[model samples]
Target: MSAENGTPETPAGSTPPTGPRPEPIRFFGTSWVGHDHGYTARRIALAAGSLAAAAVACLVLCLAYQGLQIADIGSFVTLLVVVMFAVCSALAFRHTWAGFSSRPDPDRQASLRGLLTIGFIGSLLAYAFRCLIEAPGEKLHRTEYEAARARHEKRTTRRSGNPKKRRRP
Candidate 1:
Protein backbone atom coordinates (compact mmCIF):
# COMPACT_ATOMS: atom_id res chain seq x y z
CA MET A 1 0.00 0.00 0.00
CA SER A 2 2.84 2.44 0.72
CA ALA A 3 4.64 1.88 -2.61
CA GLU A 4 1.79 2.99 -4.94
CA ASN A 5 -0.06 5.31 -2.54
CA GLY A 6 -2.97 2.78 -2.50
CA THR A 7 -5.19 3.71 -5.48
CA PRO A 8 -6.00 1.05 -8.04
CA GLU A 9 -5.59 2.12 -11.67
CA THR A 10 -6.93 1.11 -15.07
CA PRO A 11 -4.42 -0.20 -17.58
CA ALA A 12 -2.18 2.51 -19.01
CA GLY A 13 -4.20 4.83 -21.31
CA SER A 14 -7.13 2.37 -21.32
CA THR A 15 -10.47 3.00 -19.66
CA PRO A 16 -12.05 0.58 -17.20
CA PRO A 17 -14.35 -2.00 -18.79
CA THR A 18 -18.07 -1.32 -18.76
CA GLY A 19 -21.11 -3.41 -19.48
CA PRO A 20 -23.23 -2.50 -22.52
CA ARG A 21 -25.69 0.38 -22.18
CA PRO A 22 -29.21 -0.59 -21.21
CA GLU A 23 -31.68 -0.78 -24.07
CA PRO A 24 -34.56 1.64 -24.05
CA ILE A 25 -37.83 0.48 -22.55
CA ARG A 26 -40.66 0.55 -25.04
CA PHE A 27 -44.08 1.08 -23.51
CA PHE A 28 -46.86 -1.31 -24.44
CA GLY A 29 -49.34 -0.06 -27.20
CA THR A 30 -47.21 3.02 -27.66
CA SER A 31 -44.45 1.75 -29.93
CA TRP A 32 -46.82 1.18 -32.82
CA VAL A 33 -48.81 4.35 -32.23
CA GLY A 34 -47.45 5.98 -35.36
CA HIS A 35 -47.10 3.46 -38.14
CA ASP A 36 -48.18 4.08 -41.75
CA HIS A 37 -48.46 0.89 -43.71
CA GLY A 38 -51.76 0.43 -45.54
CA TYR A 39 -52.37 -2.80 -43.67
CA THR A 40 -51.66 -1.09 -40.41
CA ALA A 41 -53.93 1.76 -41.33
CA ARG A 42 -56.68 -0.63 -42.34
CA ARG A 43 -56.29 -2.51 -39.09
CA ILE A 44 -56.56 0.76 -37.26
CA ALA A 45 -59.78 1.43 -39.17
CA LEU A 46 -61.04 -1.99 -38.22
CA ALA A 47 -60.19 -1.50 -34.57
CA ALA A 48 -62.00 1.81 -34.38
CA GLY A 49 -64.87 0.41 -36.40
CA SER A 50 -65.10 -2.57 -34.13
CA LEU A 51 -65.17 -0.42 -31.03
CA ALA A 52 -68.12 1.51 -32.41
CA ALA A 53 -69.76 -1.68 -33.50
CA ALA A 54 -69.31 -3.18 -30.08
CA ALA A 55 -71.02 -0.24 -28.40
CA VAL A 56 -74.00 -0.76 -30.67
CA ALA A 57 -73.85 -4.45 -30.02
CA CYS A 58 -73.98 -3.82 -26.30
CA LEU A 59 -77.03 -1.60 -26.78
CA VAL A 60 -78.71 -4.36 -28.72
CA LEU A 61 -77.76 -6.80 -26.01
CA CYS A 62 -79.34 -4.59 -23.40
CA LEU A 63 -82.49 -4.30 -25.44
CA ALA A 64 -82.72 -8.03 -25.96
CA TYR A 65 -82.04 -8.77 -22.34
CA GLN A 66 -84.75 -6.40 -21.27
CA GLY A 67 -87.30 -7.79 -23.69
CA LEU A 68 -86.58 -11.41 -22.79
CA GLN A 69 -87.55 -10.69 -19.20
CA ILE A 70 -90.57 -8.57 -20.23
CA ALA A 71 -89.07 -5.76 -18.21
CA ASP A 72 -90.79 -2.42 -18.16
CA ILE A 73 -89.27 0.18 -20.47
CA GLY A 74 -89.10 2.65 -17.61
CA SER A 75 -87.25 0.16 -15.45
CA PHE A 76 -84.84 -0.91 -18.19
CA VAL A 77 -81.34 0.53 -17.76
CA THR A 78 -80.61 0.48 -21.48
CA LEU A 79 -79.86 4.15 -21.68
CA LEU A 80 -77.30 4.06 -18.90
CA VAL A 81 -75.66 0.94 -20.24
CA VAL A 82 -75.56 2.34 -23.74
CA VAL A 83 -74.09 5.59 -22.59
CA MET A 84 -71.38 3.82 -20.63
CA PHE A 85 -70.60 1.56 -23.55
CA ALA A 86 -70.52 4.47 -25.98
CA VAL A 87 -68.11 6.44 -23.84
CA CYS A 88 -65.74 3.53 -23.44
CA SER A 89 -66.00 2.59 -27.09
CA ALA A 90 -65.34 6.11 -28.27
CA LEU A 91 -62.22 6.30 -26.13
CA ALA A 92 -60.90 3.05 -27.57
CA PHE A 93 -61.56 4.26 -31.10
CA ARG A 94 -59.87 7.57 -30.44
CA HIS A 95 -56.67 5.80 -29.43
CA THR A 96 -56.70 3.67 -32.54
CA TRP A 97 -57.51 6.61 -34.81
CA ALA A 98 -54.83 8.78 -33.34
CA GLY A 99 -52.27 6.01 -33.64
CA PHE A 100 -52.77 5.52 -37.34
CA SER A 101 -53.55 9.10 -38.22
CA SER A 102 -50.73 10.64 -36.29
CA ARG A 103 -48.10 8.50 -38.02
CA PRO A 104 -46.40 9.79 -41.13
CA ASP A 105 -46.69 7.89 -44.40
CA PRO A 106 -43.83 5.43 -44.36
CA ASP A 107 -43.44 5.43 -48.15
CA ARG A 108 -43.69 9.16 -48.54
CA GLN A 109 -45.39 8.46 -51.88
CA ALA A 110 -48.40 10.44 -50.73
CA SER A 111 -49.77 11.92 -47.58
CA LEU A 112 -51.68 9.32 -45.58
CA ARG A 113 -52.87 12.08 -43.31
CA GLY A 114 -55.99 12.61 -45.41
CA LEU A 115 -57.06 9.00 -45.08
CA LEU A 116 -56.32 9.12 -41.39
CA THR A 117 -58.29 12.34 -41.07
CA ILE A 118 -61.31 10.90 -42.82
CA GLY A 119 -61.21 7.76 -40.73
CA PHE A 120 -60.86 9.83 -37.61
CA ILE A 121 -63.84 12.02 -38.51
CA GLY A 122 -65.92 9.07 -39.52
CA SER A 123 -65.16 7.31 -36.26
CA LEU A 124 -66.00 10.47 -34.37
CA LEU A 125 -69.35 10.79 -36.11
CA ALA A 126 -70.19 7.16 -35.53
CA TYR A 127 -69.32 7.44 -31.86
CA ALA A 128 -71.23 10.70 -31.53
CA PHE A 129 -74.35 9.23 -33.08
CA ARG A 130 -74.20 6.22 -30.87
CA CYS A 131 -73.81 8.40 -27.80
CA LEU A 132 -76.58 10.75 -28.87
CA ILE A 133 -79.07 7.94 -29.40
CA GLU A 134 -78.31 6.70 -25.94
CA ALA A 135 -78.12 10.06 -24.21
CA PRO A 136 -80.17 12.51 -26.23
CA GLY A 137 -80.49 15.24 -23.61
CA GLU A 138 -77.12 14.77 -21.94
CA LYS A 139 -74.00 16.67 -22.92
CA LEU A 140 -71.15 14.81 -24.52
CA HIS A 141 -68.38 13.66 -22.21
CA ARG A 142 -66.61 16.84 -23.39
CA THR A 143 -63.37 14.92 -23.16
CA GLU A 144 -63.48 14.23 -26.86
CA TYR A 145 -63.70 17.48 -28.81
CA GLU A 146 -63.77 20.24 -26.24
CA ALA A 147 -60.08 21.01 -26.01
CA ALA A 148 -59.45 20.88 -29.73
CA ARG A 149 -62.53 22.92 -30.59
CA ALA A 150 -61.75 25.41 -27.92
CA ARG A 151 -58.21 25.89 -29.23
CA HIS A 152 -59.48 26.22 -32.78
CA GLU A 153 -62.07 28.75 -31.73
CA LYS A 154 -59.50 30.71 -29.81
CA ARG A 155 -57.14 30.78 -32.77
CA THR A 156 -59.93 31.76 -35.12
CA THR A 157 -61.10 34.51 -32.78
CA ARG A 158 -57.60 35.93 -32.68
CA ARG A 159 -57.23 35.74 -36.43
CA SER A 160 -60.59 37.36 -36.98
CA GLY A 161 -59.60 40.35 -34.86
CA ASN A 162 -56.58 41.09 -36.99
CA PRO A 163 -57.12 44.01 -39.44
CA LYS A 164 -56.28 43.28 -43.04
CA LYS A 165 -54.97 46.29 -44.87
CA ARG A 166 -55.56 46.56 -48.59
CA ARG A 167 -52.80 44.81 -50.56
CA ARG A 168 -50.59 47.44 -52.18
CA PRO A 169 -49.14 44.82 -54.57
Candidate 2:
Protein backbone atom coordinates (compact mmCIF):
# COMPACT_ATOMS: atom_id res chain seq x y z
CA MET A 1 0.00 0.00 0.00
CA SER A 2 1.04 3.59 -0.65
CA ALA A 3 2.52 5.32 2.39
CA GLU A 4 -0.01 8.15 2.19
CA ASN A 5 -2.95 5.79 2.48
CA GLY A 6 -1.38 2.86 4.24
CA THR A 7 -3.99 0.36 5.40
CA PRO A 8 -3.70 -3.11 6.86
CA GLU A 9 -4.91 -5.96 4.65
CA THR A 10 -7.69 -7.12 6.93
CA PRO A 11 -10.08 -9.57 5.39
CA ALA A 12 -13.86 -9.14 5.42
CA GLY A 13 -15.53 -9.51 8.86
CA SER A 14 -12.17 -8.87 10.53
CA THR A 15 -11.66 -5.91 12.80
CA PRO A 16 -10.02 -2.82 11.30
CA PRO A 17 -6.48 -2.11 12.40
CA THR A 18 -6.06 0.72 14.86
CA GLY A 19 -3.79 3.71 14.42
CA PRO A 20 -0.70 4.32 16.51
CA ARG A 21 -0.67 3.93 20.27
CA PRO A 22 -1.82 6.89 22.31
CA GLU A 23 0.74 9.22 23.82
CA PRO A 24 0.86 9.74 27.58
CA ILE A 25 0.18 13.12 29.15
CA ARG A 26 2.66 14.10 31.80
CA PHE A 27 3.78 16.87 34.20
CA PHE A 28 7.26 16.86 35.67
CA GLY A 29 7.84 13.58 33.84
CA THR A 30 4.88 12.00 35.63
CA SER A 31 2.01 11.08 33.41
CA TRP A 32 -1.59 12.08 33.98
CA VAL A 33 -3.56 8.86 34.21
CA GLY A 34 -4.59 8.93 30.55
CA HIS A 35 -3.36 12.07 28.78
CA ASP A 36 -0.52 12.28 26.25
CA HIS A 37 2.69 14.22 26.88
CA GLY A 38 1.63 17.24 24.84
CA TYR A 39 -1.63 17.61 26.75
CA THR A 40 0.18 17.24 30.07
CA ALA A 41 2.71 19.94 29.16
CA ARG A 42 -0.01 22.43 28.35
CA ARG A 43 -1.80 21.72 31.63
CA ILE A 44 1.36 22.21 33.64
CA ALA A 45 2.16 25.44 31.81
CA LEU A 46 -1.27 26.77 32.68
CA ALA A 47 -0.81 25.86 36.33
CA ALA A 48 2.58 27.57 36.45
CA GLY A 49 1.17 30.69 34.85
CA SER A 50 -1.62 30.86 37.40
CA LEU A 51 0.89 30.47 40.21
CA ALA A 52 2.79 33.51 38.95
CA ALA A 53 -0.43 35.46 38.80
CA ALA A 54 -1.28 34.39 42.34
CA ALA A 55 2.11 35.62 43.54
CA VAL A 56 1.50 39.03 42.03
CA ALA A 57 -1.95 39.19 43.59
CA CYS A 58 -0.61 38.23 47.00
CA LEU A 59 2.10 40.87 46.80
CA VAL A 60 -0.52 43.49 46.06
CA LEU A 61 -2.71 42.30 48.92
CA CYS A 62 0.20 42.34 51.37
CA LEU A 63 1.07 45.89 50.46
CA ALA A 64 -2.55 46.95 50.79
CA TYR A 65 -2.92 45.23 54.16
CA GLN A 66 0.17 46.90 55.58
CA GLY A 67 -0.98 50.30 54.27
CA LEU A 68 2.60 50.83 53.06
CA GLN A 69 3.53 52.34 49.75
CA ILE A 70 6.02 50.47 47.56
CA ALA A 71 8.52 53.20 48.39
CA ASP A 72 8.25 52.40 52.13
CA ILE A 73 9.77 48.95 51.57
CA GLY A 74 13.59 48.98 51.72
CA SER A 75 15.25 48.51 48.34
CA PHE A 76 17.13 45.47 49.65
CA VAL A 77 13.91 43.81 50.87
CA THR A 78 12.15 44.49 47.56
CA LEU A 79 15.05 43.08 45.64
CA LEU A 80 15.09 39.94 47.78
CA VAL A 81 11.35 39.35 47.28
CA VAL A 82 11.65 39.86 43.53
CA VAL A 83 14.59 37.50 43.32
CA MET A 84 12.77 34.80 45.26
CA PHE A 85 9.76 35.11 43.01
CA ALA A 86 11.94 34.83 39.96
CA VAL A 87 13.56 31.64 41.25
CA CYS A 88 10.21 30.02 41.97
CA SER A 89 8.90 31.01 38.56
CA ALA A 90 11.95 29.55 36.92
CA LEU A 91 11.45 26.31 38.80
CA ALA A 92 7.83 26.11 37.67
CA PHE A 93 8.84 26.71 34.06
CA ARG A 94 11.58 24.10 34.19
CA HIS A 95 9.24 21.55 35.75
CA THR A 96 6.74 22.06 32.97
CA TRP A 97 9.42 21.56 30.32
CA ALA A 98 10.75 18.44 32.03
CA GLY A 99 7.33 16.83 31.82
CA PHE A 100 7.45 16.88 28.05
CA SER A 101 11.03 16.03 27.08
CA SER A 102 12.87 14.12 29.75
CA ARG A 103 12.93 10.84 31.62
CA PRO A 104 11.54 10.83 35.14
CA ASP A 105 13.91 12.18 37.80
CA PRO A 106 12.80 11.54 41.34
CA ASP A 107 15.12 14.11 42.91
CA ARG A 108 13.98 16.92 40.65
CA GLN A 109 10.35 15.95 41.09
CA ALA A 110 10.73 16.05 44.87
CA SER A 111 12.38 19.47 44.76
CA LEU A 112 9.56 20.77 42.61
CA ARG A 113 7.02 19.58 45.15
CA GLY A 114 8.61 22.01 47.58
CA LEU A 115 9.51 24.89 45.24
CA LEU A 116 6.31 24.74 43.22
CA THR A 117 3.92 23.78 45.97
CA ILE A 118 1.00 25.44 44.25
CA GLY A 119 1.65 23.26 41.24
CA PHE A 120 1.15 20.27 43.47
CA ILE A 121 -2.14 21.65 44.76
CA GLY A 122 -3.36 22.53 41.30
CA SER A 123 -2.26 19.17 39.94
CA LEU A 124 -4.38 17.42 42.52
CA LEU A 125 -7.40 19.26 41.17
CA ALA A 126 -6.31 18.66 37.58
CA TYR A 127 -5.97 14.95 38.24
CA ALA A 128 -9.68 14.73 38.88
CA PHE A 129 -10.47 16.67 35.70
CA ARG A 130 -8.16 14.44 33.71
CA CYS A 131 -10.27 11.44 34.54
CA LEU A 132 -13.11 13.08 32.66
CA ILE A 133 -10.88 13.80 29.68
CA GLU A 134 -9.29 10.35 29.66
CA ALA A 135 -12.38 8.25 30.00
CA PRO A 136 -13.28 8.21 26.31
CA GLY A 137 -9.71 7.63 25.23
CA GLU A 138 -9.37 4.73 27.62
CA LYS A 139 -12.54 3.17 26.27
CA LEU A 140 -11.25 3.51 22.73
CA HIS A 141 -7.98 1.83 23.62
CA ARG A 142 -9.82 -1.06 25.21
CA THR A 143 -12.05 -1.55 22.21
CA GLU A 144 -9.14 -1.50 19.83
CA TYR A 145 -7.19 -4.01 21.89
CA GLU A 146 -10.14 -6.36 22.01
CA ALA A 147 -10.72 -6.09 18.26
CA ALA A 148 -7.08 -6.83 17.46
CA ARG A 149 -7.14 -9.85 19.75
CA ALA A 150 -10.30 -11.18 18.15
CA ARG A 151 -8.78 -10.76 14.69
CA HIS A 152 -5.69 -12.71 15.74
CA GLU A 153 -7.81 -15.52 17.15
CA LYS A 154 -9.90 -15.73 13.98
CA ARG A 155 -6.78 -15.95 11.83
CA THR A 156 -5.21 -18.64 13.95
CA THR A 157 -8.40 -20.69 14.05
CA ARG A 158 -8.77 -20.59 10.28
CA ARG A 159 -5.09 -21.42 9.66
CA SER A 160 -5.39 -24.52 11.82
CA GLY A 161 -8.62 -25.38 9.92
CA ASN A 162 -11.78 -26.74 11.56
CA PRO A 163 -11.24 -29.68 13.96
CA LYS A 164 -14.63 -31.17 13.00
CA LYS A 165 -13.58 -31.32 9.29
CA ARG A 166 -10.45 -33.31 10.20
CA ARG A 167 -12.43 -35.64 12.50
CA ARG A 168 -14.90 -36.48 9.70
CA PRO A 169 -11.99 -37.58 7.48
Candidate 3:
Protein backbone atom coordinates (compact mmCIF):
# COMPACT_ATOMS: atom_id res chain seq x y z
CA MET A 1 0.00 0.00 0.00
CA SER A 2 1.09 3.60 -0.67
CA ALA A 3 0.94 6.44 1.84
CA GLU A 4 -0.19 10.04 1.09
CA ASN A 5 3.35 10.96 0.16
CA GLY A 6 3.27 8.31 -2.62
CA THR A 7 5.86 6.19 -0.81
CA PRO A 8 5.21 2.59 0.14
CA GLU A 9 4.63 2.04 3.84
CA THR A 10 5.66 -1.00 5.83
CA PRO A 11 2.81 -3.30 6.76
CA ALA A 12 1.66 -2.95 10.37
CA GLY A 13 1.97 -6.67 10.82
CA SER A 14 5.71 -6.64 9.97
CA THR A 15 8.33 -6.39 12.75
CA PRO A 16 9.84 -3.00 13.32
CA PRO A 17 13.37 -2.21 12.19
CA THR A 18 16.18 -2.81 14.65
CA GLY A 19 19.75 -1.53 14.63
CA PRO A 20 22.20 0.46 16.70
CA ARG A 21 21.52 4.18 16.99
CA PRO A 22 23.95 6.51 15.26
CA GLU A 23 26.50 8.12 17.51
CA PRO A 24 26.12 11.85 17.98
CA ILE A 25 28.83 14.04 16.46
CA ARG A 26 30.63 16.03 19.09
CA PHE A 27 33.45 18.60 19.09
CA PHE A 28 35.28 19.33 22.29
CA GLY A 29 32.46 17.78 24.34
CA THR A 30 29.88 19.91 22.54
CA SER A 31 27.48 18.22 20.10
CA TRP A 32 27.44 19.83 16.67
CA VAL A 33 24.51 17.81 15.29
CA GLY A 34 25.89 18.97 11.92
CA HIS A 35 29.29 19.31 10.30
CA ASP A 36 30.87 22.65 9.49
CA HIS A 37 34.62 23.10 9.32
CA GLY A 38 34.60 26.74 10.42
CA TYR A 39 32.56 25.92 13.48
CA THR A 40 34.71 22.92 14.25
CA ALA A 41 37.90 24.95 13.98
CA ARG A 42 36.52 27.66 16.22
CA ARG A 43 35.45 25.13 18.84
CA ILE A 44 38.80 23.38 18.76
CA ALA A 45 40.70 26.67 19.06
CA LEU A 46 38.45 27.74 21.90
CA ALA A 47 39.23 24.54 23.77
CA ALA A 48 42.93 25.25 23.36
CA GLY A 49 42.48 28.76 24.66
CA SER A 50 40.50 27.48 27.62
CA LEU A 51 43.26 25.07 28.56
CA ALA A 52 45.85 27.84 28.38
CA ALA A 53 43.68 30.03 30.55
CA ALA A 54 43.32 27.25 33.06
CA ALA A 55 47.09 27.01 33.31
CA VAL A 56 47.42 30.74 33.97
CA ALA A 57 44.60 30.65 36.48
CA CYS A 58 46.19 27.78 38.31
CA LEU A 59 49.39 29.76 38.69
CA VAL A 60 47.51 32.79 39.91
CA LEU A 61 45.49 30.77 42.40
CA CYS A 62 48.53 28.97 43.68
CA LEU A 63 50.30 32.24 44.24
CA ALA A 64 47.32 33.84 45.95
CA TYR A 65 46.85 30.87 48.21
CA GLN A 66 50.43 31.25 49.27
CA GLY A 67 49.93 35.00 49.90
CA LEU A 68 52.14 35.86 46.94
CA GLN A 69 55.12 34.24 48.58
CA ILE A 70 58.17 32.64 46.96
CA ALA A 71 58.12 29.09 45.58
CA ASP A 72 57.95 26.40 48.22
CA ILE A 73 57.34 22.68 48.23
CA GLY A 74 53.60 23.08 47.57
CA SER A 75 54.19 25.76 44.98
CA PHE A 76 56.80 23.64 43.26
CA VAL A 77 54.44 20.70 43.13
CA THR A 78 51.69 22.94 41.79
CA LEU A 79 54.04 24.33 39.17
CA LEU A 80 54.82 20.86 37.91
CA VAL A 81 51.18 19.91 37.59
CA VAL A 82 50.11 23.17 36.00
CA VAL A 83 53.04 23.20 33.58
CA MET A 84 52.39 19.64 32.53
CA PHE A 85 48.74 20.11 31.78
CA ALA A 86 49.30 23.47 30.13
CA VAL A 87 52.11 22.29 27.90
CA CYS A 88 50.30 19.11 26.92
CA SER A 89 47.09 20.96 26.23
CA ALA A 90 48.93 23.46 24.08
CA LEU A 91 50.57 20.66 22.11
CA ALA A 92 47.28 18.89 21.72
CA PHE A 93 45.76 22.10 20.44
CA ARG A 94 48.47 22.61 17.87
CA HIS A 95 48.21 19.00 16.83
CA THR A 96 44.46 19.37 16.55
CA TRP A 97 44.88 22.00 13.84
CA ALA A 98 47.53 19.94 12.13
CA GLY A 99 45.23 16.96 12.22
CA PHE A 100 42.52 18.96 10.52
CA SER A 101 44.77 20.10 7.69
CA SER A 102 44.43 18.40 4.31
CA ARG A 103 48.16 17.57 4.45
CA PRO A 104 49.80 16.27 7.58
CA ASP A 105 52.54 18.39 9.14
CA PRO A 106 55.11 15.89 10.27
CA ASP A 107 57.59 18.41 11.62
CA ARG A 108 54.97 20.15 13.73
CA GLN A 109 53.69 16.83 15.01
CA ALA A 110 57.21 15.71 15.86
CA SER A 111 57.96 18.86 17.79
CA LEU A 112 54.70 18.71 19.70
CA ARG A 113 55.23 15.07 20.49
CA GLY A 114 58.68 15.95 21.74
CA LEU A 115 57.23 18.58 24.04
CA LEU A 116 54.66 16.11 25.28
CA THR A 117 57.41 13.64 26.00
CA ILE A 118 59.30 16.22 28.01
CA GLY A 119 56.17 17.11 29.94
CA PHE A 120 55.53 13.46 30.60
CA ILE A 121 59.01 13.02 31.93
CA GLY A 122 58.70 16.11 34.11
CA SER A 123 55.39 15.10 35.63
CA LEU A 124 54.06 11.70 34.70
CA LEU A 125 50.94 12.34 36.73
CA ALA A 126 49.80 15.45 34.85
CA TYR A 127 50.85 14.06 31.48
CA ALA A 128 48.75 10.98 32.13
CA PHE A 129 45.88 13.19 33.18
CA ARG A 130 45.93 15.22 29.93
CA CYS A 131 46.58 12.21 27.74
CA LEU A 132 43.54 10.50 29.20
CA ILE A 133 41.43 13.19 27.56
CA GLU A 134 43.41 14.09 24.41
CA ALA A 135 45.46 11.20 23.04
CA PRO A 136 42.80 8.80 21.82
CA GLY A 137 40.73 11.45 20.13
CA GLU A 138 43.75 13.08 18.52
CA LYS A 139 45.01 9.80 17.13
CA LEU A 140 41.61 8.85 15.73
CA HIS A 141 41.09 12.22 14.08
CA ARG A 142 44.58 12.33 12.67
CA THR A 143 44.18 8.96 11.02
CA GLU A 144 40.81 9.78 9.54
CA TYR A 145 41.97 13.17 8.28
CA GLU A 146 45.09 11.74 6.68
CA ALA A 147 43.22 8.96 4.93
CA ALA A 148 40.66 11.35 3.47
CA ARG A 149 43.36 13.74 2.40
CA ALA A 150 45.34 11.02 0.67
CA ARG A 151 42.28 9.98 -1.24
CA HIS A 152 41.60 13.55 -2.29
CA GLU A 153 45.17 14.05 -3.44
CA LYS A 154 45.08 10.85 -5.43
CA ARG A 155 41.87 11.87 -7.19
CA THR A 156 43.05 15.41 -7.97
CA THR A 157 46.48 14.42 -9.27
CA ARG A 158 44.97 11.84 -11.59
CA ARG A 159 42.45 14.36 -12.90
CA SER A 160 44.87 17.28 -13.26
CA GLY A 161 47.56 15.31 -15.12
CA ASN A 162 45.48 13.72 -17.90
CA PRO A 163 47.22 11.88 -20.78
CA LYS A 164 45.45 14.18 -23.28
CA LYS A 165 46.95 17.28 -21.64
CA ARG A 166 50.50 15.90 -21.86
CA ARG A 167 50.39 15.49 -25.71
CA ARG A 168 53.00 17.68 -27.48
CA PRO A 169 51.94 19.62 -30.57
Tell me the alpha-carbon RMSD of every candidate: 20.9, 12.7, 12.9
Candidate 1 local lDDT, 44-131, one digit each (tens) = 5544664676567656666876784576555447666545545555654554444332443466424544443434434555444433
TM-score for each of the candidates: 0.24, 0.35, 0.27
Off by over 4 Å in 1: 1-69, 73-76, 101-169
lDDT tens digits by residue: candidate 2, 61-138:
467535434457776776666566556656665554444334547887786677676434333333334343443133
lDDT of model 3 at position 13: 97
Check candidate 2 and list the clashing pairs.
24-36, 24-37, 25-35, 25-36
Instruction: Report the error of model 3 at residue 65, Å.
Output: 16
Highest-lDDT candidate: 2
**In candidate 1, what residue range of length 10 has the lowest lDDT sum?**
22-31
TM value for model 1:
0.24
Model 3 lDDT at residue 125: 34
- lDDT of each residue in 1-169, candidate 3, tens digit only: 1322222245779975432222222333212223333445544555565556556655665675575244455767767666665677566555443443335567865766766553332233333333444432444555564676677667666765567769797
CA lDDT of every candidate: 0.43, 0.49, 0.48
Model 3, runs deviating above 4 Å: 1-73, 116-169
Candidate 2 Cα deviation (angstroms), residue 102: 2.3
Residue 168 error, candidate 2, Å: 24
